[model samples]
Target: MMAIFQPFFNIISETGRVVQFFFQMLDVWKRKSISRDLMFEQIWKVTVQSSATTALAGFFVGAIMTVQFTMEMKDFGALGYLGGLSTSGTIREVGPLLIAFMLAGKVGAFTSAELGTMRVTEQIDAIRCLGADPIQELVLPRFIAIVISSFFLLGLGLLLSIFGGMLLGKYFSGVNYEEYLRHIPTIVSLPSILSGLFKCFVFAVVLAVICTHRGYSTTGGAKGVGRSVVQTAVSTMVAIVIADWATSLLADIALKIFLRSR
Candidate 1:
């Protein structure tokens, strides 16, 4: 029992070290100078590379939501509300959640595997020997990239998902395109957009930091890298779900307080 507990304690300690490293890197912005290149790479990997997956997920989610909601609305003679319902639900919840999940599978795993490989192969050591900061050279670039890419991808995903929902609503629920478009403004307000963007940004940061930390802390060789990759992806997905719920809850509370003050 003591032996088992000892391993758990070590794991916890290592995890704490990883978290500290992430915060320390963020503090000095050590890689600020190379941020642009890293941003571009991250944009390409997290945003462009994951486009197809995000789009497919968004389309399916939108289509399914529209279908189910339309059926229910039709039964209740509220089919006219399909446009507003679809837009509100997708923008407020589904869009960010789905996109984050997709990115976790794609970008998150890739980041961990790449960094883990570098660590195991001694490339990271070589950089350190040259007096280069590994966090600045690797982690910082990927961090900025993911954050920027997440915002753009989430925005694109929202638009595409909303459009997909609208198409289904128009076809199956008999909603007119013009009317749906006009009603969308009512459901998806500025606040909703801001909320979605904010969630995306948070998700990006969390995903990048966790994945990079996992990679950097990896030991052993091939097996270790593989484990880190899987762990990073799994941890990122769990973190995103938790973060999403927390953000929504906080946003709701703030909105309520602001409205009362107004």
Candidate 2:
């Protein structure tokens, strides 16, 4: 029975190691050898390269949500509120959740595979032998890049998702640009926007921890690297869902408190 839960135990252990690695790297930031170059490279690799996928998915998700919601509202002759409804859904739930899922598959897997290979080849060990901190030189740059890029990606994705819904409303639902967007202010307030961004930041941290931990701990050479990649994807996706739910719950409670005060 312990064997059945072994992987879960390993995950917990990895999470701890990743946390420790983060703090150790944090202490080394004043060192000259800490490479800003690597961070930029990772930005290009993790964020810029993945932008197309995020935007495309956002557009389609928004359009589909608009279509579905508009159709349903039309049944009761209240379709005029379609823009507000769709945008609220996109920003509050679909946009953050969907973008995180896509990024987990793209960026998360790449991180794990790359780091896992380095571990298996003993390249990480070689760097350590030279009195270098591999986690600072290696993991920190990727970690920073992932978090910053995820922030930008999630925001852009929300915009694209709203744009997609607007387009659908304009061409198919006869909403026109102005009418389609008129309700945005009413439905999506400051707290609502902040909540979505909060979800994104939390997801970024979760993704970084899971991917790096799995990658750095990889075993068994080529096969282990492959396993780490799969584990990164699965664990990240699962974490994203859980983080999304938790953040959403918190947002709801906060919103309620604010409303009561007002």
Candidate 3:
């Protein structure tokens, strides 16, 4: 009877260990002297490496939206509003969300796999043996990098998407470039842009921290590393969706309160 329960007990013990490891990671911020080089490396890898994919996706999304909306507008004789509608929708929602999703698959997975490999190869252990803090060296820099990178990527994605939409509108929908540009400013609100930026920043931080933590905790060599990579991507994406909703709700409430006060 005791033998049967031993495996279950061991499973519970492992689960407890993982939970403890997560809390320990939360304490990483207390350390001073973050690694600037590592942060830059992370930014380059997460942001620059991801740029092409995000840009391509943004272009297609913008082009398709323009086409679809133009068709609808044609039916309603409101084709002139296509530029403003497409720009507003893309910048405010589609652009940021798409870029974040791409980063979760690309940067998030890469970060997890890189750290997971280090863990399996005992590189992280070597750092620990040298009396260096893994959290400060490994996690903090990547966290900051991803947060900054996300903002830049989101902004770039917005620009590319808007460009794609404008070009498509001009060529296919008979809308001129100047007319498209003229309406964009009116449609793009400061609050909406700020909200998107804020969301991207939060998304990036969550991705980096969670993925790094997952990799840092890997144990069983190659298999563990692989598992960490998959888990990191999945978890980061789920977190992004949840965070987006929460941010939107909070922003809406705050806006309402501010308007009432005004």
Candidate with top lDDT is: 2
Q: Residue by residue across 153-213, what tens digits does model 1's lDDT show?
A: 7777767777787788778778877866777777777677777777877778888888889
Put down candidate 3 lDDT per residue, 1-262, tens digits, no spaces: 8999997897577557545655666676664677778878878877888899888888888898899999888888877778788877886677767887888898788878888999999999999999999888887777778778888888778778878988999999998888777777787777777777777777776676777778888889899989998888777787788888888897788768777988
Candidate 1 vs candidate 2: which has greater lDDT?
2
Predictions in order: lDDT:
0.80, 0.85, 0.80
Expressed as tens digits, the lDDT of each residue in 1-262 for candidate 2 is 9999998898788667867866665676556455888888898888787899999998888899889988788788766788888888887778778878878989899989999999999999999999888888788788888888987898778788888989998887878888788888897788877887888788888898789878988999999999999988988998888888899899999999999999
TM-score of predicted model 3? 0.87
Q: How well does candidate 1 score on lDDT at residue 86?
A: 81
Clashing pairs in 1: none
